[model samples]
Target chain A: MPIPLIQLAGVSKQYGDVRAVDDVTLELEPGEFFALLGPSGCGKTSLMRLVAGFETPDAGRVLIDGRDMQGVPPYRRPVNMMFQSYALFPHMSVERNIAFGLVQQGMAKGYIATRVAEMLRLVKLEGYGARRPEQLSGGQKQRVALARALAPRPKLLLLDEPLAALDRKLREETQFELMQVQRDLGIAFMLVTHDQDEAMAMAQRIALMRSGRIEQIGDARAIYERPASLFAAEFVGEINLFEGEVVQSGEGKFAIVQGGGRIALADDTPLPGPVRIAVRPERMVMSHLRAGSYAEFAGVIADMVWLGDLTVWRVRLSDGRLIRISRSNADAANAAFSRGDQVFVGFEAQSARMLLS
Target chain B: MSLVKKTRGVGDGGLAANLGRRLVLIVPYAWLILFFAIPFLIVVKISISVQRDGRPPYEPVFELADGFIGAWESVQKFSMESYAAIYADRIYGDAYISSVWIAALATLCTLLIGYPLALAMARAPRRWRSLLIVLAVAPFWTSFLIRIYAWIVILKDEGLLNHALISTGLISEPIHIYATQGAVLIGIVYSYLPFMILPLYNALEKQDTALVEAALDLGATPFAAFRQITWPLSMRGVIAGCLLVFIPAVGEYVIPDLLGSDEVLMIGRSLWDEFSTARNWPGAAAVATVLLVLLLVPIVAYQRSHLQTHGAAR
Candidate 1:
């Protein structure tokens, strides 16, 4: 197998009492689109900084392109970072900003001009070369930042919350554009972001981080369906948790003795003692009539919210727990349920994941 | 709409409010006219008057008791000899040139020294920044004259600096720094360093550090990043600091008088000599007026260009 483009072997960084990055070890193949997904203070940005050589790891090693990166300053590293704040030089024109990296390398002036034009065209900004950073709009500035970072053609590119400043519509448009650029260049990209939707939409694989530790690493579907822990289940998407004790076990089949009712799973291992079952809101089906095949909970709809494409119903179960169930608005029968109405919220056994913590 | 109508109502209270608003505008205008404009006009009148041996030492051209015709006749008696005398004398020319040269050199030295200090303070941890700022301005608490006096004690031939250098074997003899232009330059730079540092600190502190990081990440070395990013960005502060130091240093009196020898001619010393020793009030006024014009031209040009660029950037 070919060597990985970027690798961090048991890297750790500490800031006073807090450990910003705790023993993070990961690798990205060349031309891979990976994202470090977490909330603020989760050390995702710190991990990216470690790879970019901004913050030296307190322990372990950072390797890029099969070479150890110890004692390497950011200037000498074969990597670039697009900062959260665009960090464009306000005094320089757009063309100058894009050509900055090339000029630093002492490239030929003619080649620098050609490469700057190519980058500007790649970012879809052709005639804005002479304008200063202050003259550009937010989206234009973001494009300029991207162009500037990409001009050097590094082995890997690190982006720290590149779309956090844009509005929703702009963010969505830029997300697709960014993915396209990454694909076109075929360069490894490691994106750091707090927004789950942005990570889900742009990244090929997502590493969920919590409190300076990696909670789980998988594609969006695996992370959403098979969360490794309670934090992962709740952090990625909306999850309805059920506290139960597994009484029966064997042959990938188990029965959970919950306070409200007995839940039997056909596709889960029989873990003894108390466990928490996490079910995604969209996975659970709601019906007015009781369904005997699935593990069902009888409850009354306490709240109903009409989203654009789906309606979420909060059902107060007989055990005094509120379980949220979302139904597609495309179905006419699903709209029959309303607040104060009796309903049964059920989910397939395969959809529910048993959480140990 | 009701609030708008209420605000626009032409009632007695509204009239009183209008008068109060007018008073707010008029007070500062009255102060400028009385304190600044009138005094400036008096100086101009004195600068063109004939010097005489009297209590005031200059002929008063305008008399209120004399009517408008008599005032016109007195205007004819006003002489342009003081301005002509300053123009004809090479001493005044040499003083002007020396003052500009000294001030320009001091400003350059102050910029070189202040830039690094300000950059360091700006990059210091957030908790220590305020303390650093306070320390930078702490020298201002002492009297300016007393500080100059303190410099004398340290810079004299047998003083602390020379003794330390001698003891360290860095010098074989005591340097003749005191009572020279070098001492005056040192004094000016020391006194005006805070002026250079404060504005530079403000500018450097306001910069987004990511810009420097971006420069480094783009393959530029740390020094190159500073040259390409930090220096260009801190130019506004550089200009402000230079003007602050250069303007005052050009017309400085105390530092030159206390630290400089008789050979180091400066316009401030010449003006002082004309006023007290030579007893030439008109000549002194002429010197002061010329210096004011010399400083004001650059100040006005800098302000206009600053405003124009700022407006365009906005």
Candidate 2:
């Protein structure tokens, strides 16, 4: 296999009493779009900083393109970072800011001008060359920042909460434009964001982190459908967890009983002792008549909210447990169930996954 | 009450705020007229008078005791002889040139020494910054004359500086540092260093360090980043500091009198001699007026340039 564009091996960093980045080993294929997804203070930004050479790992190594990057300053590194604050030079015009990195590389003035114009066109800001950063709007400033970071054509690019400053509509538009730019240039990108939706929408692969450790690393579907731990399960999306114990085991099938309800799985390997099953809110079906083919529970609609595209209902089960179920607005009959309506909540065996812890 | 309310529009702040705003503007103008403008006009009047053997030593340009017509006649008799005397003398020209040269040199020295010191203080850890500022201003706690006296003790031929140099074997004999132009320069720089540093520190401390990091991440070295970003951004402070040092140094009297040799004829020393030793009051007033006009050139230029930059920024 070809060498990975970026490789982090057992990297760790400590700040005073806090281990900002724990032992993390990761690799990204060339031209890959990856994300470090976590909440605030979860070390995602720190991990990006380590890769950018702003902070050296207290232990282990950072390798880029098969070369060890130790004792190298940020200026010599073959990577660039778009800071959260944009950090555009306030005194320089937009053309100067975009031409800064190329000038540092000692590119010719004529070529640098053409390159700056090309970058302005790429970011859809063609006629704003002479304006200072303070004169630009928030979204325009963000585009200028992106253009500046991409002007040098580094092997890898790092974005730290790049869209946190924009409004929702602008953020969505920028997200699509950013992905397009990354794809067009064929450069590897590593985005750091606390917004899970942004991470899922942009990154091809995501490394979900918690308490300075990578909880899971996979594509969005795997992380959402087959979460490794309870933290991973709850962090990605909304889910209904049923705590139970193993009551029966058979060939390629097993059953779990929780209070007045029972759940059966199709797995051949039987789990012992207490276990939990996690199912997404959209996976659970609600109907007036219970289907004989699925294991079901009797519940009453406790509360419901109607989102434009989807409707979510909180159902109170016979055991006094509240489980959330969501359905798309595609079906007209789905809106029939309102508060206090008696319904049967059922899930197919394949849709639920057993959690060990 | 209804008519008054109708007359007062929504945008207006009513009578109280208008009075308050007027007071804010009037107080400083009143102070200037009483303390500054009146005295300055009196000096101008004296600068145009004729020298005579009298209690005031100069013919009064205005005499209210002789009534309006008499005062008008005296005003018509105001002479331009003192100004002509200053223009004809080479000593006054040499003194003005040397004073300007010395002040310019001292301002340059302060800037060269103050820039790095201010940058270091700005880069220092946040907890130690207050202490550093306190230390920078600590010299002001002592009396100004006493501080100059202390410099004399250290810079004299057999002073502490020469003694330490001799003990370290750097020099075999005491050097003539006291009573020279170099001593005057040293005194000016030492006295005005805080003026240079305080404004620079204020400007540098408010800068966003993330810009420097962004420059480095874009492939610029630390020095290049400073040249491209930090220095240009702190120019306002540099100008303020230079003006603060240069203006005062040009008209300084006590330091030059105490530290400079007799050969270095500064305008401040010349003014002192004309007023006291030569007892030429009109000549002294003419010299002071010229000095004020000379200093006004830079201050007005700076103000116009400052307004232009601010206008562009807006």
- For model 2 the local lDDT of residue A309 reads 97
Alpha-carbon deviation at B139 in model 1, angstroms: 1.5
DockQ of each: 0.85, 0.80
Candidate 2 Cα deviation (angstroms), residue A257: 4.8
Model 2, span B222-297: residue lDDT tens: 9999999999999889999999999989988999998887887789999999999988999999999999899989
Provide the lDDT at B239 for model 2.
92
After superposition, the stretches of candidate 1 with alpha carbons farther than 4 Å from their true spots are A247-252, A260-271, B1-32, B63-66
Worst window of 10 by summed lDDT in candidate 1 chain B = B4-13
Clash pairs detected, candidate 2: none
Q: How many pairs of residues collide in model 2?
A: 0
lDDT of 2: 0.91
TM-score of each: 0.94, 0.93
| TM-score, second chain, candidate 1 | 0.91
Off by over 4 Å in 2: A246-257, A266-271, A289-297, A318-321, B1-19, B63-72
Residue lDDT tens for model 1, B1-314: 98877777757678999999999999999999999888887888899999999989999887777799989999899889999999999999999999999999999999999999999999999999999999999999999999999999999999889999999999989998999999999999999999999999999999999999999999999999999999988988998999999999999989999999888888999999999999999999999889989999879988997998788687
